[model samples]
Target: MKLLRVGPPGAERPVVLDGTRYLDISGVVSDIGEEFWRTDGVERVQAALAAGTLPEVDVTGLRIGPPIARPGVVLCIGMNYATHAAETGAEPPEHPVMFYKAPNTVVGPNDDVLLPRGSAKADWEVELAVVIGRRARYLESPADALSYIGGYCISNDVSERAFQLETSGGQWSKGKSCETFNPLGPWLVTADEIPDPQALGLRSSVNGEARQDSSTADMVFSVAHLIWQLSQVTVLEPGDVVNTGTPEGVAVSGRFPYLRPGDVMELQIEGLSTQRQRLQSAEQEA
Candidate 1:
């Protein structure tokens, strides 16, 4: 089942998409949060849909919000793709390069990406995001890690290079945590539907020009490996999101130009779905 959150920003209601129509799950389930996915929420919704118990909703009239709400952590893997690492002139690390983005950065799929004040190197990175379903600790192997996954979604890893590298003594989080840095959703596709996350193709374009383009197959650290590695250090809880890193063709990769006001970003991954967002000046925030 493909789950989503629709309506205004703070008042989004749970919804499940069945073909071109939507079913309002708000009456059956509250919100698309940790509690929902941790339990048998997906199964329950599927059963309801199968039993013809879900009410048909008018998704066309509602605004969309990030499919998941209040994620415990926004964990990200840096340079997970070999080509992405090569494009940035970095060597592939033996272990995953991990970082954190505050949950406050999370926003809906179609929301505008703010070009933070004093920011000149605002960039775009299209990535595949993983939503954790169950608690996991010290995962024994890659196979063990796969069992913890709940679903997948499309994510835009908006970045500011100057703050990330030069201003913060090379800490990536400095450029990564700005408000509205993470744009997720449109839908949360169940794991069973995805079959193989690594085989999907992903691409991003800015103002109609292509920037990031690659497949999850190019990842240096596969999804299963990253999960296994992370579980060894920290417990993976329900509703935690993991951004598996972007591919080559990012603005910082030196092959393309950086983003500016009025620039639009469109991204898509197989099975997960597509998302589009326009860029606005930071002045809006002031």
Candidate 2:
């Protein structure tokens, strides 16, 4: 099932798409909060839809927000794709490279991406994001890690090369935490819908020109391994999002030019969904 949130920004209600129509699940599960997905809410909604108990909602009248509310953490993996690493002139690390992005940076699909002040080399990276369904710690194995996931979504990991690399201070968080850098969702596709997460084809384009285009098959670290590794140190709570990492074709990979004001970005992954974001001027952000 394709689950989503629809309405104004802060007032979005839970909804499920069934073919061409939408069923209102807000009456049963309110917003896409932590409790909603953690407490078997997906199963409940599936039962309701099967029993014809949910009310039909006209999705055409409302705006769509990110499928889930503010997650507790927005974890990210860097250079998980070999081709992407090669393009950047970096060797693939033996272990997963981790980072964090504040939840405040989360925004809806089709929202305007802001070009932060003094950001000249802002770039785009399309990645597949995982949403955790259950609390986990010290996961025993890769298989155990897969059991903790709720579903998946499309995420644009917008970056600023100058802040991420040229700056002397810290990790990539500076270039990554800019507001509106993470545009997630058109829908949160349940895990059952995705037979093989590793087999999905992912792609991204800037202003109709293709930028990042590759398959999850190229990921240096698999999804299950990432979850297992992360759970060893930090607790993975319900609704915590993990951006698995981007594939080849990012601007910083040197295959293409970087993003600028007025450029639009569109990204998609099989079974997850697609998203479009328009780049706006820094003056507009001010």
Candidate 3:
């Protein structure tokens, strides 16, 4: 099942995609959030739809917001793709390299991305974002990790290289946590719908020029393994957002120029959905 949130930025209401139409599910759940994930919200919405009780919404000209609302943790795995690591002049890690982007960086799919003040090296990373369905702690094996996931969505893991590498004192979050840096979702496709997350094709482009074009098949660590490994160190909570990492061909490799105001980025993952964001300058400090 595909789920989404619609309306203005902070006032989006929950809805489910049905046969090219969006059905209002707000009456069934407050929002597609922690409460929804905690209470078997997907099943409840499915039952509501099956019973013909939900109303169809006219989504024309409305804004599409992030699929999951107010995620507690925005965890990210760095260099999960081998080629990406090589492009950035690093050896493929022996284990998952993790970092955290503030949850407030999350924004709607088509929202305008702001280039932070004094920024000169903002880049785009298209990644498959995993949404946690339930709490997971110390999972016995990688085979058991899939059950902890709620759904999947597309994430544009936008970053600023200057802050990330030159200024970060070895930390990556400052470069990644800029406002509207993470553009997520046209919709969230439930886990059951995506039988194999590693098989999907994900790519990105700037100003209609192809940039990163690769498949999840190139990932150094599979989704299940990342979940299993993360569970060993941290508790994966419901509604948490995990960006699995981007593939090769980003501007960070120096093959292309960094993002500038007026540049546009388009990201897509087969079977999930597409996202487009135009770059604009954030107000400069006085």
| Top candidate, metric lDDT | 3
Identify the leading candidate in terms of TM-score. Answer: 3
How far is 47's C-alpha from truth in model 1 (Å)? Answer: 1.6
Stretches of model 2 off by over 4 angstroms after superposition: none
Model 1 bad stretches (over 4 Å): none
Backbone clash count, each prediction separately: 0, 0, 1
- Residue 250's lDDT within candidate 1 is 88
Q: Tens digit of lDDT per residue, candidate 2, span 1-286? A: 8999988878888999999888899878867769987788988998999899888987776778999999999999998999889989999989999999879888998889998888888999889999998998999999988888898999988898998889827789999999989999989988888767899999999889887778999999999999999999899999999999998888886668888888889998988778999899768877
Task: List TM-scores for all candidates, in order.
Answer: 0.98, 0.97, 0.98
Model 1 deviation from native, Cα RMSD in Å = 1.0
Screening candidate 2 with a backbone cut-off below 3 angstroms (N, C-alpha, C), the clashing residue pairs are none
lDDT for each residue of candidate 3 in 75-143, tens digit (9 for 90 to 100): 999999999999999999999999999999999999999999889999999999999999999999999
lDDT of 1 at 271: 82
- Model 3 C-alpha lDDT versus the unseen true structure: 0.95
lDDT of 1 by residue, 63-111 (tens): 7899999799999999898888888899988889999998999999999
Off by over 4 Å in 3: 284-286
The true-versus-predicted C-alpha distance at residue 271 of model 3, in Å, is 0.6
Which ten contiguous residues of candidate 1 have the minimum total lDDT? Answer: 54-63
Candidate 2 lDDT trough over 10 residues, lowest sum: 30-39
